[model samples]
Structure formats: C-alpha cells, structure tokens
Target: MTSNSPKVLVFAGSAREGSLNKQLAQLAAKRIEALGGQATFIDLKDYPCPLFDQDIEAQGMPDNVLKLRAILAEHQAVFIASPEYNGFITPLLKNTLDWLSRPYEDTPGLGLFAGKWAALVAASPGGLGGIRAMPLAQQLLANLSLTVLPQPLSLPGAGSAFDEAGALKDDATGQKLDALCQRLVDSLAKTHG
Candidate 1:
C-alpha cells in the first residue's frame, strides 16, 4: 500500500511567472532531492477548475481534478508555497484542495492526503511574505486529516532573494528554506514506511 520511492510533493500556489513562492518551492525540491526524497511540484496553472457547482458535480468531476488527486496519491508528503490573494489563500489553491477532497468523506486515492505530512512556505514582495494564506491552508489540510508541520517560512522580499537565473541569492533565506525542506524530507521518511 506504499511506494518504493519516498515521495515528497511540492505545491507552488502562485500563478505568476515572477512568483517568488514558486522559487521557494523550487528550493524545496532541491533540498528534497538532496535528502534522498523524490520531489514533484504540482503547478496550479496545470490545475485550473471552475467554481465548484452542484450542476458541475452532477456532470461528474473533471479529469484534471482527478489527475491532481492521482498526483497526491503518489506522494507521502507535501510542501505548499502559497501566495496570498486578497488577504486569503489563493482561490486556485483552495479550489485544488476542494477537488482533491472529492466524495467529501470516503474515497479511493483521495485519501492520499489523509495522515500525510505537509510543510508551508510562502514568498511575496510584500512585507508579510504572503503569510495571509497560511492559516487557511493549514486548517484545510488539518480538516482533511493531513499532518501539517508547524514551521512555516513566509519569505518576504523574495524578489531580491533570487538571481537572474532563478538561483537563490540570499544565504539566510536559503538556509531557512533548507531547514524547512529538511523537515519535509524527515517527515516523509518517517511516515512513508
């Protein structure tokens, strides 16, 4: 009922090309691989769905939603890098979680997120580092019975933290991301087996 490879999924919750949150996710992936975990990032751009509707539900769930759930089923843990939209979690991120939680109660691989560990990270040009989104993400994961790590890194001033090639430039922020990602790797290692 488990996998041979240790799966560490990374969710980049922002949709902008200049998304600093995505950079944090990229950094997390590097650290995951460094710690012997397989890192996979689920980009929200690839997971766009309309506002959930009962009418839409009557038509059956969408293929893209199922595919995203399948990706969750493949992983043992998650590292979410979310952007704050209108002082809350991005609708894209929330909607993805919504689709992932289909059947509301019992379901097949949709249960993949249950009991799985998750870590939070955020990046933004604003002073708060897109942190406005963290509480909601954590709560939703908890509602799904996912074990979310408490150490969240809200990466403010993210624009200066990376270079032209997207490499992390700030040693302090890099170290922070390193520590957060290590937690994910350790959590996955402990939980996957």
Candidate 2:
C-alpha cells in the first residue's frame, strides 16, 4: 500500500534496557504516529560497525556504514536520543556519524544526512540535563550537512520521567515530547515540501 506520511527515523544511541533516552525516543515516535506521520525508532544495538579511523576508512568503509546510509536515505528527517559520555556524545553515535561521512572526493554514498532535518534530544539523571552534549551533537549533525533544529528536547532528571516499562510517565514531559515531534514534522515539511 502507498503511505501518505513522511517517514522519520529516530535513533536511540543507547541500548541499555533502562535507557532513559531510548524511552524518550519511543515517546517521540508515538507522538509522530499520533500526528499522522510515520516514525521508526532505530535501536543502535542492531547496527554494528568497526571503530572509526581514517586509516581504516582508507581501506574501505564497513558494510554496516553503507547499510546505515541506505536507512537514512529512506527517511525525511531524524530525531536522536543521545546519551552523554564524559559531557559529549556516546562513542557509538560518534562512530556512526564518522562512518556515514566517509565518502570523500572519489567515493559515492552521501545519502541520509545531507539536507535532512535533525533534532537532538538528550537525557541524563543528572540535574544539569545533558546540555553539554546537545551542542556538540548539533555541531556534528551540522558537519554532516544536516540542518539541526534550533530548539531541542532535553529531559533533565530522566530517572523520573519513565516507568518500569519504559513508557513516558510524566504528563508534562509527555506534552513536551509531543511538541518536539510536532516541531520536527513541521520543520521537515517546510524545509523539503
């Protein structure tokens, strides 16, 4: 059947069963579904890649990188559930971006990221929110030719935002997340259509 909705992919950088960021991503996807938009939450656990090194890249990008770019090419926009690692992005997310950006001068395969709308959402148990990581993530997306959304969704004290089943539990947080999804859809439609 033909789909009328714009497809968006939400990547959850963390794979932990209790990942608060993942929970946030799930909620964002639900919001998109509610708004008549299609959403797919991509769990990082399913994507595998070797550690990134330019020397390693010179040999050839791993097949996983190509697969990831293919996945990105199918989506109109992206929402990322980033977790902070030492006040920056998780190494896995960083590695994924590095691999996707591997096509230089001669090689082809720069789908997914270029001209795509992206939003950064970070969650941590700490009081400061994952604020330090958001800017860096935005910069990374920018470097990849993505248009990072100016307003981001950050769940401070994420420990309190989800239930045991990983569903968003707080009403206010739910509303905020819903709004973020709407913002992403609105931004993508205006930017691409």
lDDT of each: 0.78, 0.80
Tens-place lDDT digits, model 1, residues 98-131 = 7787773257534666778888988888888888
Residue pairs with backbone overlap in model 1? none
Worst 10 residues of 1 by lDDT: 104-113
Would you give me the overall lDDT of model 2?
A: 0.80
lDDT per residue as tens, model 2, 1-193: 1275677898887878768888888878888878767888888777788888888778876777767877877898888999998899999898888787766545454544677888888899998668889999999888878888787878889988787766678877777777778888877767655
lDDT leader: 2
The pairs that clash in candidate 2 are none
Q: Which ten contiguous residues of candidate 2 have the minimum total lDDT?
A: 103-112
lDDT of 1: 0.78
Alpha-carbon RMSD of each model: 2.7, 2.4
In model 1, which runs have C-alpha deviations exceeding 4 angstroms? Answer: 1-3, 104-110
Model 2 segments more than 4 A misplaced = 104-111
Score candidate 2 by TM-score against the native.
0.88
